[model samples]
Target: MSKYRVLVVDDEEDLCEIIRFALEVEGYSVDVVYSAEEALKMNITDYNLLLLDVMMGEISGFRMAHMIRNDPKTAHTPIVFISAKDTENDRLTAFSLGADDYITKPFSIREMLARVKAIIGRFDSKMKIGLQILSYDKLTINLEKKQVLLEEKEIRFTKKEFEILKLFLENRNRLFTREELLKRIWSDEAFVLSRTIDVNITRIRRKIGRYERNIVTKLGLGYCFEG
Candidate 1:
């Protein structure tokens, strides 16, 4: 079986080695980087996931995640933050920054493995749902199920969200006009306002998280979700 490729970025050499070995044993291909600088220097796009340290020399893992998110190429890559501090606020910060998962230091190899597996499984389900699935990494919209998966967690979207997603997925690579979205999503002439369309789209994007870019905006046209 081919192993899932993983990038391990941490300042501690021994910790990196241990984590690498543990993941390798779980049938994953692992690469280790001792500092954020080295991690940034390495080509990280090909990895299935990134295990990043919150604190490191020069550049912090949060900074690195911000850099990665800024670059459209790696924007959707799943990232797990590893840190010595385990405050609720830290986790909030991590998740707010688009982290798929987080693990505190002094963690068990078994727990780490479980979390890693969960994160990988989330992406796997998303990939399996692509277009026919309407997936762009973090958001999993399964047309068949009319179900949306976020970070391996299921989210119950309102009727409007589902309809909007359905339209985009059905017409991949096509640009949608605001009028089209509004007309299609709402049948009542009175309720079909331009602001309604914009509001629903923003709600969908907010819930969609990370994959928000998949729903592209055209100043004159409208939006396309199939990119």
Candidate 2:
């Protein structure tokens, strides 16, 4: 099995070293940075999870997490806050800023290791079956994984893009009117506008790359997914 990559950002060198050493022992790839500024410089999404210290020079972990979630590149990456501040309010603040988990300082290595494993495990499981992967021509849709591959390169699809792809692949070569697509994709939701389907289809077609021309628009009729 491939190891999970974890980014550990803490201003305390000794503490960061200790955690890094411990996680490495458990077969996790660990990257340690002393400040949020340095962590931001690195690619945030490449790591499976971020172990962030709420306190740091130049930028706090909370602020950095905000920046990360705002960027499409790392919006979905899981984050955990590690801080000495153990107050309820502090923990709430961390979670409000998009933290997946919170661990206080003075925590046992054993417990910390377990929490890390648990959080990453949940994310790993989710990616395995969350998206529906569809294969047509050279295009591959990893629907459960929320990923698409074109010519062997991983293509990132936003939530709506993946959903629209899944619907078309499930019924390939079939013509779908805008109303039908809205009903199929947003089944339970009442009153989804036709424009929503158009926007999603536009995004999906762009990701289709060379296959973009394959998906034909039937004028006023609607859209069809062709090989």
**Every candidate's lDDT:** 0.86, 0.86
Give the per-residue lDDT digits (tens) of candidate 2, residues 1-227.
23689999999999999999999999999999999999988988789999999889989998999999899888878898889999999998888877889999889999989999999999888776544457887788775566788987898888677778777787889999888777777888867778888888788778778888878899999998886
Any runs in candidate 1 off by more than 4 Å, and if so which? 133-227
Question: Using alpha carbons, what is the TM-score of model 2?
Answer: 0.62
lDDT of 1: 0.86
> lDDT tens string, model 1, 189-215?
666668888888899889877778788
Q: What TM-score does candidate 1 get on C-alpha atoms?
A: 0.60
lDDT of 1 at 34: 89
Candidate 1 backbone collisions, by pair: 129-133, 131-134
TM-score of each model, in listed order = 0.60, 0.62
